[model samples]
Target: MSRAGSRDPALPARPRRTELALLLAALVLLALGFASAEGDIRGQLSGTVALYAGALAGAALALHTALRFLAPWADPLILPLATVLNGVGLCTIWGLHRVSDPRASEAADQLTWTLCGIALCGAALAVVPRPRMMQRYPYLTAAAGLVLLTLPMLPFVGIDAFGAQRWIGVAGFTVQPSEFAKILLVVFLAAYLSIKRDVLSLAARQLTIGSVKVFSQPRMRDLGPMTVAWGVAILLLVGTKDLGTSLLLFGVYLAMLYTATQRKSWVGIGVAMFAAGACVAWALFGHVQRRVTAWLTPFAPDTYEAEGGSFQLVQGLFALAEGGLTGTGFGQGRAADIFASDSDLILVSIGEKLGFTGLAAVVVLLFLLTERGFRAALESREIFVKLATSGFAFLLAFQVFVVLGGVTRLIPLTGMTTPFLAAGGSSLVSSWIIVGLWLRISDAARRPEPAAEHGADAATEVLRLRSG
Candidate 1:
């Protein structure tokens, strides 16, 4: 008979049934959404529906096949969840396109970018056979990230649009490098913290008022790196004039630091620093002041007519109000009336047409993705993988919060795009790449132990029992 506790070595058929099923479901849901928006709203069928569906299905299949063959043990939920979210975005954009500029083919462009992003994701998986290998180049990745963040400010190459110089133009194409910078910076922090975590956690001073200890604070010497990080964030704000990305980068750093050191005091310090910086920026920058004014009193005529007016913000709120409970139903809503409906105000558009029910579903999907990233981090064997995965998760969570909160007027409108659901090619591509990295890390964390190792342990146990 077979040896007791021995396992099959013939590569277990991880056929990924769950992924295939979910992909099919996502495709059907997308098709139904397109049909509803087209037939119910426009009262006719368009040729582009078939084209969009075919492109999405093909792109999803391509990525799915790659993961199955290359990273079979990868988290099955990430790709499928991304597919559903991307599909919803495509349908929504297509619906918006019908009203905004029917002839522009922006929906088709989004589909093309989605394919490119999937291809890039596949390349990432192929390039980094193991996620742990990335720990080797923390500083190099950090340097590259900084360079990318600074590129959009270059004299000739930089493109100024929507009051922020956050994109670089090359050969007629504009690219936002900040999206990719988030990933590289996360990598750097993960590697850096993996080495310094023990020291940072242990070398903290406890503070007390009289009898009760308030909190444990890091040493003044240890504060140098965080202070430097703060300066870099401020520089990013001043240089690019992009508050969303600057906030995102800094929020991610703070989260990673806390996760590494497990110090609640870091949270207090980071918040205080961010608040102080925001006050300074508000006082110094006209644009910052205008955004705050708009958020506070958007309906005021004076605020409404300014350069960066509250017109868009007020309109987005009206759109959401129009959505109400069940939404205006696909294409029936006036989401297109709002500026940048497919990007900065996408949540508003989604809220308007899909209503509270649909919007809630979307939010749940986002949180689910974040949860998977956190799960990967927890399961990871190496400290670097854990911190990196956690950072990526926090990045996604914080970004979604910023986008949704801004659109709802809970916070000043920051020019940030909703991931996967937004119109920007750079944002879409970078989101996919982050998902790819999460999958790689999850695969490494969850892969089955070698049969030899298992058998060896069983044999050792049996020998001990025999001796006893």
Candidate 2:
């Protein structure tokens, strides 16, 4: 019998057949949806259909080819899953165009954004060949993140729409700075936490509610980081009024800290701080108060009609109810009736059209994506990589929960977009960049160590010298 430590035969490199098949299936589904929605396969194919189909196919193939060569050991399902969801979203948006407004170019625009997102993903993979190198610039990333987060609050460039200053206008293009800022923020948190994990885990104080010892708090120095994070979150609330982005960034920070130290005390402290901050915002800001009130009493007539009230929330709930089982079948439901069906409420539109079954599939796909990220985190050799990958994974999971939970009336609406399904260039691009990071990290983590190669090369050199 072979010993456990003995080397086995080399495994063949994966050709990614599963990924290719899934990609083809996703493209087929997109074409089918377009054909069905238009009711004219021949004419649509001769014009607009060909353009989107070609673009998606080319983009998918380009990314796949890059992965095949650049990162063969990376998880295969992630890219294809994102592709399928994105394609379905494009189809759904295309269908909603007729119902919401004819001549709307949302689908075409989304396709262009999708292509741009893929291009960015490729660029990220090329630029950041190794995930470990990112750990060297924690301060730089943190400073850049702060700048990006603050950009949308500037008077000259910032645009206030829908009662929130969450966008900056640049050259006639509106960009959501918080979307990209979150990525930079996560990287900084990961790098910082990896270095301070030991110091943070050290208990500075023991607290007891009554007789039972509850939790141990970190030192004053350790507390400084959490304070800064909380202050930033509060600033975000006061400045941009974007509860979702603030909550997301702060939540990611807390999670990474806890993950680094395995300390429940940190989470408890974070939650308590969040609650306090939330109460203060509720007391100080009328809009924040209105949101809490609407969340608690959405069906109230006054609350439903009030500006920024539960009207959209009530409409979304009604739409979800209408889409009982298998959905109203694409393009059959009046999802367009709800405001912003293409962005914040895209999931509602999806629920109305495809029903619970389709929604379940989307949720499962998200879970799978998040699962892959966690797996990479677990397998990674470096502490920074582990923390960064896990933090990124949690960000995706929490954002989905926040968005879906908000629309379902399970929580207050926070005006966040569903990852790939939502129609926003900033969101789409950011999510794709996350995907690139995941793939790059996973490839590095899973690829066999080079010790064996070095050993083989040394033996070859020795043999050549002896023969000579």
Candidate 3:
């Protein structure tokens, strides 16, 4: 029987040590932060601590309750990893808020968003049955995805953000559809590619390359759907000015396709197509030109005037440059006064305050998560599971590469948040939700006997006897 359905008896379930440790460490850091900021806030620590503590407690309870029920097969580390990173982010946000921008109490807002994201991750973990089930709803998922991708297009619904309409205000709260759309698209792509991988792998004539055989380019039968999908994505992104999401999604599609087939040729073709697409975009799209120019020379702060396009990026570099090694210290950054501080420039603020060490720690956490995710993918038995999970890893790696590189001037400005660490409802929610899916896949691919394995020897012996 699958571990999910096991009627294991004599087991005394409790929180994993890692979960407890995470909460304890987070609570400690949170307490220290509150104490340090007590004089500044003036008798507000009691209230603020109560609020934040309550939120953490509630999030932990919800997550624990979820693992006990829905995804008994899930990894114990996934939720805790998310909680730790997000908790640190919000705490740091609050710290920055205390000094940098007193008018902006981003801590409270970040806490609220973290709770929402935790709730989302918990719910998804609790009831997502299996990651494979997502394949059944590709059409619905894809449609919803398309609507989100087009949302920034509607002036009424979309918020004018960094010259890109990436947000929608519902009632009063803002949401980024592209964040959620990326994951849904991954599901759709996994479903589509799993079925298509075999055909694409088998149907082709071989050509000799330096006495080595290579498959020629895909025929019309092979190219039609992939081309159409690519065109649709490109059209929507170029039209709406959502290049970051578009490039991230397109990169994911190519990575998944190659993973599904183990073909170097597909990657070569993808790179060629990307170069071609970039050339076309640069010629036709003026916005692309500005972004590229800024990426190449973000240090040109004088050239980045109000009328120009590189202001955000130039300011970002200034923030990073100001933050040399040990940082300006928590709650002691000057960059928060800059426009869009909470969104695209959060990383810069982090660099200014947390220094290179803090920045490196955040990156390392992400690297660890990616490593775990890729390991999960490698261990997966089902092709769909492997492709989908690998896609998750690839998406994180590439998205980080995009956003961090953008802020650091390694690439053009994408204005996207640093996943798990950046302050955005869209980024937080989508990242946690993807973690849930990755956890589910990891659990399914591995952990065949979870509840049983976690149980005490005495309890297991009793259960074994009872079963016998």
Candidate 4:
């Protein structure tokens, strides 16, 4: 195999020295924060600010890795966008503690999680030298993803939060393995599609009817592997009572399949399959049924059973309306009025406090990051890189659409997050990892290749010498 990318030659003379300097500065501030005399929480633990500054320092290092390991590639816009979103998450997490019933030192815990998440992001960048290195463990990665999706089935491992069983409790800390699962899922899909793209695209039948040639509908034989994979994913989600995950995973498959084949027919088939599955799920699963029904008439009249389930959705709308055009302010949203305002309702928090400005800001940043990711995919020559980046970018965009769309009454509330801008360690870390992969693809797509003729003359001379 070819060697990994070389160090960035055009990087400034000082390069990561600046980032290191900031980290050291952050540590010093953190130390002083502990030592400073304090009568209030803010005065005592200026540690929160120091910790976030450290997070920024870590982000710079990851950006450097993008330049080296991914080669010559950079997302000039993505890192800064993530910085703002992560900063927003941290700030919102801190400020909202004014009301959390469990309090559990919300801001301090968030700072701790932010520190942990950043550490995890740095370690991933450190260990995964080349993104393809992850390809070696395709089965293992997919299996791990299955395990994460199945966590809620294991009794005590997963937690039930506002009707979604998405969190895993391990040791002393609770985490959402699904966050990490999403990254590994991308790796597995990229590798799988790389190997199967030709078969998937080529294994087909065609028929001419009346003058039009159309491909035959796929057979169970042709679709066995994909069907099995999709069935397993859906079963895992339904088993775990996580319809949100079910929807997300299905979208990933559809996006990957479409990219690998570039077929418009598959889109129609996919919509059909999705509609069929939804009908099946809604009929057999009461939880899924409840979610759909609640979404259908969150504020509509006369459904006697529509009473309890719409509570969350209505509150989400109320928060958004409260914020109006301009937000209440950075640190002052009345989010506690809604149950579970911290997670699923985080958009509500943004909408209420930042109003249209903050809400618009959140939407724009993710949109820019997603756009850059697709740009990287378009630039990539490697099939896996193209599919990987594009598929994952679609995943982020779709998740945002689902969650935000739901909470804002644009769609049903699927209980998903707003990516990095929401609280939760798994969400935070997975988001940066997504950013890392985007950086990798962007680097590969943009990495300046030495001119194809860089050694042509020397190669000819060497050949002449050898022949002589």
TM-score-sorted candidate list, best first: 1, 2, 3, 4
lDDT (0 to 1) per candidate: 0.84, 0.82, 0.73, 0.68
* Of 3 and 4, the candidate ranking higher by lDDT: 3
lDDT per residue for candidate 4 within 1-468, as digits (tens), equals 033433356552232344345435544543332233121223334454566556555655555554444333455556556656666666665556643532457666666676666566556555765556666767787888877777766777778865667777888778877777777777788878787777777777766788897755555575676567567867877776778877887888888878887766777788898999889988987777767777787765543236447777876787788898987764345675676576778888878866888789788878987887888889877777788888789888988888888887776677787787777777877887777667655654554555435567756754553232
lDDT of 1 by residue, 163-279 (tens): 898899978778998888888888888888888888889998889999998988887676565456446744875688988888888888888988998888989998998899899
Candidate 4 Cα errors over 4 Å, as ranges: 1-8, 11-72, 99-103, 219-222, 300-308, 330-333, 450-468
| Candidate 2: residue pairs that collide | none
**Which candidate, 3 or 4, would have the higher TM-score against the true structure?**
3
- Model 2 / residue 188 / CA error / Å: 0.5
Off by over 4 Å in 2: 1-12, 40-46, 208-213, 456-468
Comparing 1 and 4 on lDDT, the stronger one: 1
Compared to the true structure, candidate 2 yields what TM-score? 0.91
Off by over 4 Å in 3: 1-15, 33-46, 449-468
In model 1, where do residues sit more than 4 Å from their true spots? 1-15, 209-212, 220-230, 451-468
Angstrom error at residue 9, model 2: 11
Question: For candidate 2, lDDT tens digit of each residue in 1-468?
Answer: 033433333321453666788788888877776776665212343356667777888998899988877877777777888888788788778778765676788887899899999988888888988887888888788778888888877889999998899899988778898888888888888888887888888756878998896988888787677457546744864678888888877788788888998889879988998899888888888888888888999999999999999998889888888888888865567678778888999999888887898888888888998898999999887888999999889999999999999998888888899998999889999999999999898888876554434578866764553232
* Cα error of candidate 2 at position 349, Å: 0.3
**Candidate 2, number of clashes:** 0
